[model samples]
Each structure stands twice: as structure tokens, then as C-alpha cells.
Target: MIRIRLGARGLGGVRFAVSPMGSAKDLLRLVGFNPGTLTPSWRSRATDALTRHRLGLLAVVGGGGPLGYAPDFLRPEPPAFLTDIDTALHQIATTPQERIRYELAEAVNGHSWDPGSGHPAPRQLLQALGRGEDHFARRLADEMARFWHAALKPSWPAIRTRLEADVTARASDITQYGLAEALNRLAPNLEWRDGELLVHLRTDSIHRLTLDAEAVILTPSVFVDRALFCAGEPPGTPAPRTPLIVYPAAKVDCLPPAQDPLIGATRRKLLAELSQPRSTTEIAKRLYLSPATVSYHLQILHRAGLVTRARRSRHVLYQRLGGMV
Candidate 1:
């Protein structure tokens, strides 16, 4: 069933009230960057969105630079020396496994809806709940973390008390695994020692680093820089909104070859349009439907492992999942 649950959500500045599910790579192109090159800035933004919301995109494309300066929520509590920000970004960039663990913990703690493909089905929730602890694999943490965040409220106040408790429990779990302490301790130091002006990171550790630059990010979310909290405090600290996407299952083709009309028609259109790589509105106009309807179709196609979806400014773009056919 389609749903809208929020606490942390994102779509660049749009605050994505709705996100249609699809393969992560497809999501990359739709968001605005060419997947072929996989730009660091775009990856940073998409990862930030995913980190906060965990909509199931395999990866995200660049929409633009992060909004304003890094917000306070992303900064460490009470702040520290400017070197700390550099340190955090450096470590994150250097260690992908830590980031993956962090993301995985988030997926387990926050949103872990089972579209019911493989392990950890919704039925397993009860069993998982009864279990004492959540295990996180550093290798898988990056993508898993994005998925986990899906469970959180888009903002703090809107969050359920129990979820808040879950956040604490998860935090404990993270401490057990070392993500929290690592970020607080090791990460910031990395940037400081590296002597880089900006540190860029991705899932599975950092993909890039730049010294003699400006601004750095530990997670892809550009909104929060470790440096900000050290510089000063922020007001209100608006949390990033949560993002969600729903799609019918019959459409995706992850395991083996499969076909369904609802899935096939939509998939065909996505492939045809990829050459030009049109935006959501353009696809809707071409498909002759409302933007919302077009989005829903894309969502289903996405979940079924067919097409990809992305947000560019106010638009939600779509691309063929892959194989060019």
C-alpha cells in the first residue's frame, strides 16, 4: 500500500512530499547527474538525501550544491575546533565501511519496510523486534543506512515517542558497532591531518578529498557540515524532511526474467525516453497524464526493477533502469 510517513525527507529544496520507488541507479540519472561519470557533488547530495530519508534508490544524481551552509542538525553537538570538521570529513572519506555501518544502523532503526523481495520480510519484523540486537555489516552499511533512515519521522517533533526510543536504542547499537564514536573521534581527525580544505565522502568510505578547498561533508547531506556547529549554533534546527516512494511489485525484474502489462508498458516508455533523458513534467506531458499519475507509474516500474526516478529542482525525472532495452 502507498504511504506517506515523515520525519526526515528530501528532494533538493522541494522537500519531496512524495517519492516513487525504483532501482537506485535509475534514481541517479533522474536526480540530474549522468550516471556514467558519477560526479562527487551530485553523489554527495543524493547520498545526503538518502542518508536522511532512505528512499530506495541504488544511488542518486546531483541536483545541485547543498542548500545554504551546513545546518546545525548535521553538526556535532556543542561543536569543537575547525580541525574537527576537517577530521570528520577526512575519516568518512577514508573509511567507507564506517559510513555503511552508520547507514545500516539507520535502516534497521528507522524505515525498513519490506517490499518483500528477500530476507527481512515484514513478517520478520516481529521476530527481529523480539531479537535483542541489530547487526550491521560495514560493507553493506552504506546502502542499508539509506534504507534504514526511511523509517524515521521527517522531523523531530513529528516523530513517535517509541521511534525516539528506537533512535536511542539504535544509537546504542551504533556505539556497539563504533560508528558514532568513530565519527565523533576518528573522522574529524582525518580531515585535520589530511590538511584538506574540503573532504568528500560516499558510501563504503570516502571517494574523494580536496585540500586547500573550502567546506567539507562527512555524509552526502550537504546541509550539515561538522564545521558549522564549531563555528556557531543554528536556530530551530529544521530537520531534513523524509522521502518515500511506492510501487507495485509485478513490474521489477531483479531475480529472473518476468513480465506483466502494467510493468512492461511503463518500462518500454522509460527506455525510449532515456536517450533524451526528460524530466518528470516532460514525461507526464508525453505520457498524457497528471504529474502525480506519471510519478506513480514510475514508482511501480522502479520497485519492479525496471525504471529509475529522480528530482531536479521541482521536477521528478525518470530513466530506463538499464540494459538500454
Candidate 2:
């Protein structure tokens, strides 16, 4: 449990931010298959994506545990709303060597109060960084780049749209429901009580913090189903003015492809089947649609620019177009 005592100014100090680095880190966690803290539905969806990509560094970066901690350098303060991947990567590359070592130590060393198991992969990687092995650091950075392009960039437009919608919803909540209500609705385990905000963390340990003047930055995330609380400063120290709280967005579905209600059921089924390349007979067999009906729907899908066809040894396979979703 985490308790944050808020001063008089806390109510008006709340702010909303969209964090690109945070989202990337969250997706890295999903790639590592560490969805123990996520909702069942999200876990299933994330697991499917991870299996499809099979990123090698995901398991390594996950640190061989459910609590895989990506080095903090990867998550800088949220940059501009449209911060590019290269800019974020450059910031990470130039992180002060000392800061990298310090954050890595904190992540690897078990918290003084809680003796929960720690992650080894990060520990080893930290050692490499400690030795000033810039090569290893560069390698990890490359993996981050690859992971973002393959796993995230493809669905980023949809994710960004959902994030914007969430921000709009939060703004409405603050106006209509008031600040306290908005804070409470941030997560199931959060509550805004008299002069304080309470966060019931999944862990058994309880921690207390205070936010004197800095407003809390509330970042809505598509991947973080559970609330993630980060103290601006180390634990047990004087509380910083601004702390960050990242929680799952209200809409659980990250990327529901643009669907046309006017399109017939068979076309919808064909579009769904064509998410991956499939032959007409294969789609028909799986969807229980006749081959002729499948063919008609495929032709319609092709005409609408929703799908494309390519010849594959004695068969013409169809797949959803790149930009349609």
C-alpha cells in the first residue's frame, strides 16, 4: 500500500500527460511475458503479440522474473506529445553513466523493507554497464529500437488515438465529477480521501509519501492495466513536488480496427481472416463460409483497399493491408 499526503494545493495541481517512453517500457514488459500484474484479457492479447514477434531481448530484458525492471534511463520524463523514437533513444544513449549505475543498483538491489525475489537479467546487464561497456549498452539500445519498430510502431496510430480519447475522458471527469472523483477513478485500487491519496499496491508492504507543491502527473497507458506509482525521489527521502502515476486507460481495447457496419457479415469475416495471409479455401474452411461467398467477400475487401493478394505457389493468398488497421 502507498499513501500520499497532499497539501492544500494538491487538488488543483493534477495534470495529464501522454508518455511515449512509458508506453514503450510497458510494451517491453509485455514482450517479456510478465503480465502477472495485468488483467486477464490484456494478458491474453499481449501474450499473443509477444508470441508472434518472439523478440529475443524481451526475455533477457525481462530479467527472468515477473518483476522485470527495464533500466530507468529508457523512461525519461515525457517529452513532446509526438516525441520520435530516435530522439528518445538519443536521450537514453547520453544518460549520465553515474545515473545509469545508480538506477540500475536500485532496481537490482532488493528494497530494504521487502525481501521479494529480484531479477537476474537486469543484474547482469547492470554489471555490464557498471564496467563502462558502452558496447553492451548500445546493443540494448538497438534492441529497444527494433522492439519499438516491430511491436509498437505498427499499432501506434491506434494506440495514440485511444490515449487521446482517454485524456479527453479524464478532462471531462475532472470537470463534471471533480478532482477527487477523477483521482479515485484513475484505478480500482486508488482512493482520494481527506487530504490524502491512497494507492493499494499489489505488494504486501506499505509505503508513504508526501507531495507538497508539485502536481501529480497522471499518465494514462494502454498497456498498464494496474496502477504504477513512481516517486520522483528515492523512498524515505523528502518528497518531491511532482510524482507520476501511470494507470490503464478506460478503454481496454488498444486497437480495434476501423470497422464498417455497412460491410456485410461475410466481408467482415473475410477481413478478420485476412489479418494473416490465407488462401480462399483456408478462410472458407475456418469461417464456415462457402468458397464462392469467401471469394466474393475477398474481391470486395480488395476493392475497398482493405486487403491485398499475392501469389504463393499454386495459391493466391490474401492479407489485410498495412495501413487499413
Candidate 3:
């Protein structure tokens, strides 16, 4: 369950400090108990704050990003928060004791896609061990590696990627508690105040943090804009890119080599014919490529949720899904 100390009388009566860079709605949701009652501006303001953020440490909400590999997604049925954790641990302990394991996982399909009916709770899942008859030690280390870095998983592809993906997914209207959701989802052990989950370097509360925060995010549904505990002064006046932005670019860059030349050309031909509904063969011929190549890229795009297909006249028609803007 969400944790936050509340006051009597009203949400305003609740006395606490808030982090600076979180969704105002997350705070409002915690204090006001109204996720849907928030105004559209609340969502818009939250998005603006994220985009304006210099350090890019904010979390993603409302569906955005590569969708590369969300380990959390495993099945369609989700369990209760506590139940999910319990089951996850149980699976790790009892599932034939494989060396490698998936620490964070989620269900694959949703029973329905109702508003507020998107993601199931954390429980309601089956855990299966990895298959490998040999190399127990190697696999064990790999499994532990994921667990050790589990906290970072939710913030993957850099915080920017997560934020971007979230924005893209929910471009129209939204009720997202960005900052709180990010902290809680990324690292749930911390307490909540003003709707932002405390994710300080120090495990202690904001008061105990020896150093200042690198960043703070406010959520939607707010104007008085509480939650302003910055780590320290920003050297001078603030700009878009706050604090500093130095990195071991060459040391940690993990992007794969640019797309293969042949694959790249094939991709272009597929896109050109996606205007109206057409089968892979139709597009392939227009681009002078084989149906097999078109089908492969189509698979990738579909998995990316970019292209949609339907069976029309007993033949599948692929249409370019146009949500990414």
C-alpha cells in the first residue's frame, strides 16, 4: 500500500516537505484521494516540468520509451502489491533453484483495457526458472546481477528515455502521478510526502540526507507547488540543463552500432508503402524487396507497437500505427 502520513481536517492540514520535481497529481492523489478529478493542466504542467528538467532524472508515466525490455511484464494477470512481492520471492526460492533469475516481472496481457484498468496489481503470476542443465555458477551470478541493479531497471535507457516514452504513450489526455509513481515504482522502500517518493542517496528521510538531492520533481494537479527540497544551490542562476552534465561517454555508451545497411534500406521500403492498408507482399514489391524481409521488419514494428495489422478478406492488412509524435 502507498505510505504517507496524513493530517486531520484536510489535505492542506497535512504538514510535510515535498521534493521539487514530481507530478503534482501524485501529491494531490495522496492527499486528496482523487486521481480522476485532476485538471488537464495538471497533466500538461507535469509534462512541461519533465521536459524542462535539466538533469533528466524524472521517471516515465503514461507510456513512453523504447519498450525495449520491460522485465516487469511477464503475463496478463497482476497480483496485489504485497502478494506480488511475496510470490516473486517465493518463485525465486522454490522454482528449481536456477542460478539466474528475473527479479522484476509483470503479466503479458491485460484482461481488459478499461480506463484505470490498465495494469493489474503485482500478484497473479506464474514463475518459471530459466532452462540450463549446466553452468550453474555463471547463471547464478547473472541472476544476482539483475537483482542488484533492479532499482535502476525502472529508470532504464537513462531517465530521459523513460520520460520520453511515457509522454509519447499518453499524448492525448492523462491522469498521471509522475514523480511519486516514478519513485515508488523504481524504489518503493521510501516514504511519500507531497506525492514524491523520497529517493535520496542516503536511506534516511530528506532531513537526514547528508548531501543535497541531484534533482526533485513535482507532479501534476498543483499550483502552490510545494515539494521544493533541492540538494543545494545550482552554482548560479538555473538553466535548462541544471547542475552538471558530464559523463564517461565512451566508457558507458551502450547503443548498438548503427542499423545494418541492408536492413536500413529494407526498413525504408516498408515505411513508404504503409500509407494505406497493404500486405507485406504489396509493400515488398513496391520497394523491390522480398516478402520475407518485409515480414521480419513488420514483426519488429508490431512488437514496437508501431504497426497494426488486421485480417481483411482473409488476408492480413498492415497499417502504420501513428501514435508516435
Candidate 4:
């Protein structure tokens, strides 16, 4: 559990940010390589696209075993409305070379994976950065570009809309219920009491942070559901800790869409099966229906917005929408 002590000025500095870069990293986890802590609703068609294109960086980015660490350079503060991928890449490319060297050195030296064991692709990439080669920096940016183009860009509109809705809802909560109430509503295991914000984590470790005047960026993420992820300053950094808390947004309009009169019994069963996201293959096997038939019905449901579809890891999955019983 971690507790943050907020000073008089802390609440004033608290703000919400939408990070495109952060979303990209979260999306990477949803890909087939390493799902980390995400419970993806559907199989990852995005990952399949990445694999089919032979984007080898997927291994490096997600490759340090299950609890692997993506480089800190990928974690940038949110830029406003970040519509251009080139702009985000430019920010990464222009990171102070000294900071890059410092962060990469730390990652290689104290990575969770065994330092003396077999080197993974993430380690290899870190080693490249440690060698004072700026090419790998660009290489990282290029990989983000490819992943964004192939996987994220197509569904960005819907994702952005969901994020916007969450923001609006939270904003309303703050206005009506106050900051602490709004914060508590974000997750079940969080609370604000007597100037401290408490977070219940899964680990036995405890942390107490006091934000005097530094701003706390509370970010809403679609992929992170169960708990909160806090990104803080690395050891030996020259700057003050700028903490970013990424938490799963409260789903609002996930109710099942209106029913159609023409829908048949088999399709209804498929809809019920999609209470959570399920891939066509999984649904077919469960219902003893042919994959083709399931796919056809899913397409119809998706067209009506009665079901929502997303790609997770290597499978395309679907779920009922609009609060269906």
C-alpha cells in the first residue's frame, strides 16, 4: 500500500492528462507478447498485424520475461491532444542524451531479469543505448510508429471517445462530490483521509509520498483495470519526482445495445457468451457452433453496436454492449 500526503497546494496542482505514449505502452501489453496485468476482452488482432509485418521490436519492448520493464524513455508526460505520432516520436528523439544514458544504464544494471543470465532483447536494446548510439533511440521511435499505425491508429477514435467520456464524468464528480470523493470513486481500494491519499496495492511493500507543490497527473487508461500504476522518478535523477497515476476508468456506457427483432436463438446465445470479451474461436468452441457462423453473427452485432470488438494479443474478441442482461 502507498499513501501520498498532499499539502495545501497539492490539490491545486492536481490535474488530468491524456498520454498517447502511455496508451501505446498499455496497448503493447495487450499484444500477444506480454500482457502483463491486463485482462483483454478479445484476442489481439493488433498483435497479429505486428507479427505479420515482422516488427521485431515487439519482443524487445515486451521481452524482459512476464514482469519485464519497458524503457523509461517511453514514459513521457502527456502532450495536449497528441494527434501526431511524429510529434511524440520527436519528443522521444530529442530526450537529453545524458538522461537517456543514465536511465538505460540503470535499466541494464538493475533490470529484474538476471544480469548474469541469458540476455533478452530488452537487454540488448539497453546495451545499444548504453553504447552512446542514438540510432536505437530512433529505432524505438520507429517501432512505436509502426505499432501505432498498424494497431492503434485505426481504433483511436473510439478509444479517445471513451477517454473523453471518463474525463467528463470525473470532472463532474469533482464538482459535485469534491476531490477526495472523486478520487475514491476511481477504484475500490483507494481513499483520501486527513490530507493523505491511500492506495492499496497487491504487494506487501508500503510507500508514503508527500506531494508538496509538485503536480500529480491522474491518467485514465482503458487497459489497466484492477489497480493503479505509479510512475515515479528513477534513483539518481536530478529532477523532483513527477508522479503519474494510471488507473482504469469507470466504465459508463457498456450496457448492451438495443435488441433486434430479427436476431435468432443461436445469435442470442452468442451475445450472452460475450458478457465478457471472447474470441470467435473460444465462443465457437464453447457453443459448439462453427467459427464461420459465429463470426458472421458477431459482425452483425458489431454493426449494430450491440457488441464491441477489440484485438488483444493474437485474437480478435467481442463483447456485448449497452448493458444487456
Candidate 5:
């Protein structure tokens, strides 16, 4: 369990921003490491591009499994609401050598080195980073740029739209309902209780963070299927910066037209109705459509890898995949 205690000042300082590099890293994770809930067609295209570009360094740096540890320096908190890829890459390329050393050491300490773990020669990479090598960081940045263009750039507009919608919805929730309600709606694993935001992680270890004055930046990502917490300052940072919470955005109405031509207006409406699990009859009643029509569209969407269905007692429930968009 990871509990973040946000005082009044910390709560007031909470804001939302979008990070391109963060999404890029998540893209890498979806392609090179964990597929999570990504659609088959999209994942296939991204895989082909990754193979064509031969992003060796990126594969090593970003190849950690879904729950594996990666260096935090790879995705720095964006300074603005919408940070372009160039600016985010620059921030990574110019990371101080001391911070790089510290982060690399932290990674090394957390996991044992495995030569065949899809991470090619991580020890050598760490050694290069430890020597205050400028070229190492530059090469990393260059790889990230190439990877972004190859895998994520094509779908960036749709991705950005989804992230923006999530931010807007959450912001409105904060205004209309309250911060606590907004926080609880972020993910199923997160909860707001007693002035603390509790993140129920897969790990058994417990960590408590007090946000003294540092704010929490809520950044939504299309590739992140779950909530992720990023905090703490690397060694040589000027001061403690805002923490980041990268959660999955709602997965409706963000698909590029080229990606799925089958998603017509009716299917789109059906998808929106599936923000939560529902039965065919329930969806039909809500959308004012016949159960047969809803079932037909749901079957098409299920075949396209956009939704999943499972039996729940006497009824079957369908829900949209988290990373479909």
C-alpha cells in the first residue's frame, strides 16, 4: 500500500498536465514489454515499427515488465499542461550526471541483472551511465525521439484528445463534486480517506509519503492500464518537485478513424455506454435500442478487441478494455 498524505496546501496545489515522453514510455511498455489491454491491431502496428526502427537502447531502458522497475529519470514531470515531445526529450537529455548515477544505482539495487531478460547487457549500460557519459543520455534521448515518431506519433492526436478529456472531466469533478470524489473515480485501486490518498499497489510493502508543500500532478495516459505513482527527487535536483500520478484515461471516443472503420456512430455510442460493465439488456434499455442490436454491436466490438465479456451468474456482462484508445 502506498499512502500519500496531502495537507490543505498540498491539496490546493494539485493540478493536471500531459507528458508526451511519459506516454511514449508507456507505449514502449505496451509494445516491447507488457501488452496489457492494448488492442491487437494497434499493438501489431507498433511492434512492426519498433522492429523496423531497431530501437535497441530504448528496448533495454524501457523493456521492464509491466510491474518492473525503470529509471524515473526517463520520464520527468512536465512543466506545462501540454508538453511537446521535443521539450520532454530535452529535459531527459539534459538530466544531470549525478541524478543519472543515482537513478541507475537505484535500478541496479532493486533488481538482479539478467542478460537474457530482453534487456541487453544492462550492466554495461549502467557502467556507461555511471561514468558521467554525456553521450549515453544523448543517445537515450535520440532513441526516444525515434521511437516516438515510429510508434506513437501517428496516433498522438487521438491519444492527446483522450488525455485532455480525462483531465477536463476530473477537473470538473473537483469543481462539482469534490476532490475526494474525483480521486476515487481515478481508478478502482485508488481511494481517498482521512485526508490521504491511498494507492493499493500489487506489492505487499507499505510506503507513506507526506506531501509537505509539493503538489501532485495528475497526468492521464492512454497506454497506462492502471494507476502509477512517481515521486521523490533525483540527487542534484534544485528542490523537491511535484509528484505525478499517471492513470489510465477513459477509453471511449479517442480512436483514430483510420484505426477502426467499423466503429460507426452506433458502435461509438454503445462503447460510451460501456464505461462500466453492463448486460446487453441493460445497455439496450439505456441506449433505447433493442437487445439484439446491442448484442450485434457488442459482438463486433468484442471481435475488434475493444471490449470483453464474461458470464455473471445468469447474465453476461461486457466492459471496454482499459487501453483500447
Candidate 6:
């Protein structure tokens, strides 16, 4: 468990933003290498992309340590708004040498490497980085750019749309329902109580941190199936940086092709049924279709920008977008 005490400054600074590089990194970490929690289609796509791409260094870095810890320099803190991939990559490429060496050391030395664990390349790379090889950073950035182009860029438009929608809805929640409620609703693993936000991490260790004046950035990712918190600054850093909470965007697993044809009568009926927010089960019961069928059509409609989804308690409520009443 990670406990964060959000003081007034931290509370006021809590804001939402979309990070392209963050999502790409998470996709590489969770989908490309780890491969669980994603839908079948998404998993297949990621596997195919990884098989086709030559992302050697990226694979090693994103493969993570025994503790599932990726080097933090790969995902720099994003701005308080949507940023393009180019900008994020540049930040990684130009990271201060000391921070790079420190983080790489942490990632490498913290784990016990074996021959079958494919530690040779990483060990060599870590040695190179330790010797102040500036090219390593640029090489990492280049590989990440290649991976993004191969795996994420093709579907980025739809992914970005979903992330933006999540940010908009979360911002509205913060405005209307208060930040505590919004925090509680982010995921099943998070809770905000008595001026402190509690995050349940996969690790059993407990970490307590005070927000002080540092901001809490809420970033939404379509690739991350679970909530992740990137907190604390690298050791020996000059100043503390903002902490980030990367949560799974609602219904991200249901993303389909953005240009699916909506000619089916069932799709039309489903759209009409969404005159009010309804769940898949509700729509299936109303239209006499299986819940699976309703979910499939809804995924298509959502990708086509014709519908929006929100998790209301345990049910995901779908509604028609625009003035499509």
C-alpha cells in the first residue's frame, strides 16, 4: 500500500492530463512483454507488432526487473496537457546523465540476473551507460519511437480520443463531486480518506509519502489495464518532481477499429436504445440480444465516435455521443 497525504497545495494541484509516451511505454511493458489483462484482440495485435518489430534495447528495458520495475527515465513526467510522442521522446533522449546512470543502476543492480534471463545485452548496455555513453539515451529514444510507430501510432487517434474523454469526465467529476469522490472512483484499488489518498500496489510493502507542494498528475492510459503510481524522485536529484497516477481508461479493452461500418440494423437499434445511458446487459435485455452481441456493437459504435461509456458503480453506462437522440 502507498499512502499519500495531500496537503492543500497538493489537493489544489491535482489535475488530469493525457500522455502519449506514457501509454506507449505501458503498452510495451504490460502488453508487449507481460501480456495479461488485455482483451484478446488487443493482445493479438501487440504480439504481432512485437514479433514484427526489431526493438532489442526497448524489449530489454521494458521487460522490467524481477520486481516489475522499469527504468523511470523512459517515462518522463508529462506536461499538464496532451503532448505528442516527439516531445516525450526528446525528454527521454536528453535526460540528465546523472539521473540516467542512477536509474539504470537501480534497475540493473536491484535484480539478480541469470544467463537465461537475457542479461548479457542489458548488462553491456548498463556498462555503456555507466561509462557516460550519451548515445545510449538517443538509441533508447530511437527504439521507442520505432516501437511507437509500429505498434501504437496506427491506432493512436482512437486511443487519444478515449484518453481525452476520460480526462474530461474525470475533471468534471472533480468539479462536481469533489476530488475525494473522483479519486475513489478512479479504480477499485484506490481510495481517498481524511486528506490522504491510499493506493494499493502489487507489492506487500507499505510506503507513506507526503505530497507537500508537489502536484499529483492523473494520467489515463488505454494500454494499462491496472492503476499504476509513479512516485518519488530519483535518488540524488536536485529537486522533487510531481507524482503521477496512471489509471486504466474506462472500457479501453473494448476498442475496435475506428472506421467500422454501422450499416447493421442491430447497431442502429443499439444506438437508439442508448437514448439514455444503459449497460450492455440492459441493452441486451431490451433488444432481446445476447450481452456479448450488445457489447460487440457498442465497441464498434464507441470506436466510431458515436457513443461514450462511463463506469457508474459496477456497471458501465453507454450513451450516444453528440446530439444523436
Give the number of the best model, judged by lDDT. 5
User: What value does the lDDT take at residue 173 in candidate 4?
Assistant: 82
Q: Using alpha carbons, what is the TM-score of model 4?
A: 0.70
Q: How far out, in Å, is residue 70 in model 4?
A: 2.3
Reference-based lDDT, residue 192, model 4 = 81
Give the TM-scores of the predictions, in the order they appear. Answer: 0.24, 0.64, 0.24, 0.70, 0.73, 0.73
Where in model 2 is the C-alpha error above 4 Å? Answer: 8-12, 33-59, 62-68, 111-127, 133-139, 203-213, 234-241, 252-325
Residue 188, model 6: Cα distance from true site in angstroms: 1.5
TM-score of 5: 0.73
**Candidate 6 lDDT, 161-244, residue by residue in tens:** 767767766767777898789899888788898887777876653444444434688888766656787745533453345778
lDDT of 3 by residue, 1-325 (tens): 2222223322232211121112221322222223234334333433344444421211221121122112211110112211223343333233232212221221123211112454442221221122331332233223322322332223222333323333332221122554334333322233456633343332232233222223332211122112322212223322111111011111001112232332255554565467567898888888787889789998875655445577978789886532111
Model 3 lDDT at residue 232: 23
Q: How good is model 6 by TM-score?
A: 0.73
Query: lDDT per prediction?
Result: 0.32, 0.62, 0.32, 0.63, 0.72, 0.70
Clashing pairs in 2: 214-241
- Clash pairs of candidate 5? none
Candidate 4 on 1-325: residue-level lDDT in tens? 6666678777777888776667777666555334544343323545565687666654455333433445556656665534356777776666666656665554465442446667533545656565564776676777777777776676566566556656777887888899989988877777788887777775643444444334577877776664554545534564324666777765534312222353567777886787787999999999998999999988977765456787889999787642211
lDDT of 2: 0.62
lDDT tens per residue, model 2, 1-325: 5666777676666777776666777766664546465544345555554466664544355322344445555665554555667877776666666555565565556431113544343444545555583555565666667666655675566566557657777777778888889888889988889877777776654445444434577787777667877645544443122566788776422223333343455666666666568999999899987899889888876665456677989999987643222
RMSD (Å) per prediction: 21.9, 7.2, 19.6, 6.9, 8.2, 8.5
